[model samples]
Target: MSLELESASVEQTQEIAQQIARLVEPGDVILLNGDLGAGKTHFTQGLAAGLETPTVPTSPTFNIMFVYEGGRLPLYHFDLYRLEDADELEDIDYYGTIEGDGVSVVEWADKFEDAQPDECLAITIRILPDQTRVLSLEPYGGHFEDIVAAIA
Candidate 1:
């Protein structure tokens, strides 16, 4: 099942993400899907704050991935927009990191189906006509299902 929520502003989007952050644990994978300028980074920023990460997070568009430590758990932020194909995931050790002791958040994850885990929390942010955002949260496994229930 999917839970739908609305955000009237960028701050609201981040606030909603912070709510999810509280329930996250090590080895959690969050797949983020959204269009350009759809507030994906903003949501991630809030997640980092909720996790108590020392530094703020920026989009890893050019770098592809950014690893932030010194928080409740490590944050492995990834952007797959630059990748031409799913084969490049291996070059970045994508699978290894996501399965590591950290919470993995992948932006533009829909770009490559192979990168998606069988069990994860997948979120899609849609831009509404009024410039607001509609976020749909879907859980793919039992753990994620519990999270969605708590956040819903």
Candidate 2:
């Protein structure tokens, strides 16, 4: 599908994420990009909240990956900031999480190029002045396209 972009505040960003989450099924991957403090985690919080797992979802930076299971589908939150290489994924079961029965939201996904799964939603958030954001969503596959369309 064509890439979808929008301007949003932190709350609007979360609401958009929630709307998108309504269409996601299990085993979905999200590839996110933005500079520091681009509201990536805020979008994830909206996604988890939309999934009915309304809670404070952390960065998972130190933990590498945080799995939240109290939603309609499980949520696998991965932060790759401290990750040196994608090769270390095997040690932490990256493939397992991406191919498993859950929704995975990955922050700083630029570190993994060819390693990213085929079925993934790519997002880029640009921080604007005055606490606003420019967010773009590029769905990479048919499944993700459908989800994007639904949310759009």
The candidate maximizing TM-score is 1
TM-score of 2: 0.94
Clashes of each: 0, 1
lDDT of 1 by residue, 103-136 (tens): 9999999999776999999999999999989999
Measured on C-alpha atoms, candidate 1 has an lDDT of 0.92
- Tens-place lDDT digits, model 2, residues 22-127: 9888889998899989999999999999999856688898999998988899999999889897788888898888888999999998888877887789999998
lDDT for 75 (candidate 1): 96
Evaluate residue 131 in candidate 2 and report its C-alpha lDDT on the 0 to 100 scale.
Answer: 61
Q: Clashing residue pairs, candidate 2?
A: 27-102
